[model samples]
Target: MKLKLIRQTGIHVILAAGGALMLLPVIWMIATSFKEPESIYAFPPEWLPHPFTWSNYVETLTRPGMAFLDFFRNSMTVTVLAMIGNIASSTVVAFAFARLRWRGRDALFVVLLTTMMLPQHVTMIPVFVLFKYLGWIDTYKPLVVPAFFGAPLYIFILRQFMLTLPRSLDEAARLDGAGNFTLLTRIMLPLSKPALATVAVFAFRAHWNDFMGPLIYLNSSEKFTLAIGLHMFHGQYGTEWGPMMAAATLTVLPMVILFLIAQRYFIQGMAMSGLKE
Candidate 1:
């Protein structure tokens, strides 16, 4: 018993240390946001700001050409729309893959899975050309539309979770005159909350933090998302560390809140969807 406890304690200490190491940069960013610009690069680094100030945040928001609020709104628009599409499409496709037996279902699913192995870089140029030809350049459509087609990884996660559920529920529902759509809406969806929440969190984070997509698709400053807008902190002369950190802190806050709210479901989904072929 003592040995087991010791092993567990050691493991926990290691994990905690690793976690702290990972969080150091984030903690420093927050600290820097609070610090005055002059004190930022002080030798013998200050872990805590000597004198805290909201100036950085104020400057971040009020800075000319920054349009931080507009950038924020744009990011929220893309992230929320993309997240909704991903959840809806992924869940429906996953349900079909999990429950329905079609002639080529398994083979098609295999092909879908294979697509996951294809590097995004390989398709990026072709996708860009298609979007450009469609006159979607400088629009949010390129960033948000692909999500509605369902991401393979999200589909896989939801499908695996759905498969873990018993088919008896479907039979019982059908006996009560529940059709396919009815089964999905009433039974499968409710039971698959954990997996859905997992997908929601993933989708939100991906679209929220996506820099490359917005950079490639959006040409106008007014259409810039938070990720791309962050580059404004870098000027030809020097970097605005204080305001930049403040913006970054604000940028990260939503994802933090989201994860905190959905952590239970996220953890449950990950735990239950283990290694099922």
Candidate 2:
């Protein structure tokens, strides 16, 4: 009993230490955001600001040519469009893979999985060229349009989740005179809320934080998303640490709120999706 108690205590201590390590950066960022510029880099590295200031947030939000509200609106538009496209496309593709049987289905699945192994950089140039030819550059089309085709990872995840669902459900729908479209819409989609939420959350976050895509495709400053706006805050000679931290905090708020809202569904879908056939 004593030995077991000692081992448990040791495990708790290790876990606490690991938790602190993970939280340290977040703590530092918050601390720095509130500190005055003079005290930001003070010796001994203060964990809490001596005299906290809210000016950073105000300045960050009100900065010239950075229009926080506009950037936020752009981010939200892109995120919402991407989420809709991903959900619609992933659902149909995953349903096909999970419920429909055809020649070369397994081979096609293997090919889909193989694409995941290829680095995004390899295909980025070709994608850029295609978008350029279509006159999609300098517009949101490059970011929003591709999502309608479904992402390979999201399709795979939803397919895995769908596979775990009982075939009896599909049979019942079929007996009710439901065709493929009816079954997919009336049955599969309703039952796959958790998986769909997971896909939506992921796609929203991806497009929300995407800097490179927006930078390459959107030349107009007014159309820039939050990620691009953040990058522009850093000048060539010096960086505005306070405003930068404030903007970083603001940028993360939406993701945090979203995760808090959909975290349960996300975890549940991931857990159930791994069930073996």
Against the hidden true structure, what lDDT does model 2 obtain?
0.84
Pairs with steric clashes in candidate 1: none
TM-score of each: 0.92, 0.92
Among these predicted structures, which one has the highest lDDT?
A: 1
Q: Which ten-residue region of model 1 has the weakest summed lDDT?
A: 231-240
Q: For candidate 2, lDDT tens digit of each residue in 238-262? A: 4677778888888888988888898
Cα lDDT for residue 245, candidate 2: 85
- In model 1, the Cα lDDT at residue 163 comes to 92
Model 2 poorest 10 in a row by lDDT: 268-277
Off by over 4 Å in 1: 1-13, 235-238, 268-277
Tens digits of per-residue lDDT for model 1, 136-178: 9999999989999999888999999899999899999999999
